[model samples]
Target: MVDRDIVGGNWIEVPAGKYKKNARTLSHCQLEFNCLYSDLISHAAEGDYSKMAPFRVLSFDIECAGRKGHFPEANHDPVIQIANLVSLQGEDQPFVRNVMTLKSCAPIVGVDVMSFEAEREVLLAWR
Candidate 1:
């Protein structure tokens, strides 16, 4: 849904026009108005923004969690760490950048896959 109104959102609330909510974050957004726009996404996850002429850009780092140091036999999660965005951005890139680190790295909740124990002694007896 295209929600332009942010009521009691712990942020500013302007009259409804057009806006997009930031992925993985609440109350953060990119406002849509004059400049240039694409109706293609029409309210989806992406908004191609090169609205200005003479696209001279400076790319800040892009952050994401990805797999690295794969050891086939070992069952382990990938190196879950912040990697150098500079290498990822490429040597020719204008700015030296890496994934952004926010002071408030919001709590991320993983899917619940837990089995509750039965009444007292049910689990204890099994052990």
Candidate 2:
């Protein structure tokens, strides 16, 4: 269609006059519109290059703490901690290695090993 849809507006019908006057030159233009107000009447324009967006690669490892003096079992053991290594499209080193755990533990000086009181808290924060 010649007229593209704008989301988050509460107008009853298309403002045809406004479109004809203000948006005539927007055809084939790579433009971004943002809602400037809660009612969504006002909009600000910008440019976007989503076509050049790069893919993000994420690497991670799971650590399950088995019962004392026992081997970790996938079927029964609980995941006590999670470690993540995130690499952006062109980073030399994986930028971040974050770890979250259930039980209270000593912190590593430079690592992101955060311990929570309960496993449910970690899962909720991730969600």
Candidate 3:
């Protein structure tokens, strides 16, 4: 099967902008047809009303302390020891005993790409 998927839009790249998000990537019209939007549509077709609900989801890049330090003069050693995933639900627990590192991601709950924001962690629609 051939996948005819494409993402991008026509917007002029600006230079020397005061705004933090000062970059041109995609247009407003084009943004409406993103993969996430398509997933919602597919859910609607399947009569899944839960997809119509609004929820708070955030994606973030954490500045980890272990590897890739500042400056070219600094060493970029691979990090083997790193603290991870502390859920805020109850005192922030850590994964312990029989620790396993996932080599590849198994399908979460669907085949429609990753419904997650990259990390499996989500606040959930009702969690």
Candidate 4:
């Protein structure tokens, strides 16, 4: 389902049109709207962004398992880890940083993480 209606999103000139504020694109989005990238994921997670919706921000990074030099093809590359800071609208400080993995991984200080036996296990745990 479309999380937010595209018609109500903030419009942009470069992308040319209105789009959802916190929408994730599994495929190509419409040409005429502003779609929120990772920069706006926090807004979606908090469910409130009126105070700081205009600024572009960096959230976290995803680490995938593959050869160093050659990028792994779509079916080969596996998403081995994800780390992010989570803060709600009323929270005083963001503290839900975590890194999930599919194998034994070194613990990141001050962050919660666990390694699973299978990739599907990781997805289920994350959800």
Candidate 5:
């Protein structure tokens, strides 16, 4: 038995034009239009032609200081910096670029550098 409430399960092909027309009329549904939109794109794609949805990607890096000649341990090492870069799916440049440093740091061009006096402050800002 298949659960009809689920967005996907058994495959059934519907014409793109008909699907779009009926999908637009769906309102106050448990599933939002955005979810249906994604489903439609995935289900309606043809050979060598697919709609590319715009999405954002957030990439982050954490810097930690460790003891000499040893790998940084979570309990022992302190996080010195948290760097973040956010960009669109196909964009070459990241629109949001920022870093939260534990202490003083030199200014960087095209990047927002936030230096906090305390480690807690940096962690809070990153959060």
Candidate 6:
């Protein structure tokens, strides 16, 4: 068959052998479409390596206070702080940097520090 290149990639039309009428999975969730793995590989798009897309990346860390000699557990341990840093692709400096602490915390240069009275408040604010 001749290859047809669409806007983003080539289009491959395949016959719906069995999944034509009932397109829902066993869990009763209707999917956009279902196809076999071999069918996908046959119609895979060619990669474009000339340019890269710009996107934001977020990196975060969570600090918890747990019992000594024990791994931190969500139900048992209390989250003390949550630090976040968001940077743009191909950028030198991070666009957003902040920290949410359960209690009062020392200020850091170039970072926004948010202190909450309780752990629930801090977690809620982070969400």
Local distance difference test, each candidate: 0.30, 0.58, 0.27, 0.59, 0.72, 0.76
Off by over 4 Å in 4: 1-58, 89-92
Stretches of candidate 5 off by over 4 Å are 1-52
TM-score of each: 0.19, 0.49, 0.18, 0.46, 0.58, 0.59
The CA-based lDDT of model 3 is what? 0.27
The residue-by-residue lDDT of candidate 6 on 1-127, one tens digit each, is 2333323534455556733444454543334556554443233454643344577898999999989999999989999999999999989989899999988888899999999999999998887
Give lDDT: candidate 4, residue 81: 71
After best superposition, candidate 2 residue 101: deviation in angstroms?
Answer: 0.9
Off by over 4 Å in 6: 1-53
lDDT tens digits, residue span 13-54, model 2: 233333333434444434433222332332223244213345
Q: Candidate 2 or 4, higher lDDT?
A: 4
Residue-wise C-alpha lDDT for candidate 4, range 51-127, written one tens digit per residue: 34443232566777888798866478887776677766656667577777888798778989888888777766666
The TM-score between candidate 3 and the true structure equals 0.18
The TM-score that candidate 2 achieves is: 0.49
**lDDT (tens digit, per residue) of candidate 3 on 3-51:** 2222232122223332244256554432322232222211122244332
Q: lDDT by residue for model 5 over 1-127, one digit each (tens)?
A: 1322223332333335433333564565433323242233223344433444567898999998879999999789989999999999999999999999988789989999999988789898887
Model 6 C-alpha lDDT versus the unseen true structure: 0.76
- Model 1 worst lDDT run, 10 consecutive residues: 111-120
- In terms of lDDT, the best-performing candidate is 6
Error of 5 at 83 (Å): 1.1
Please rank every candidate by lDDT, starting with the best. Answer: 6, 5, 4, 2, 1, 3
> How many steric overlaps does candidate 2 have?
0
Worst 10 residues of 2 by lDDT: 35-44
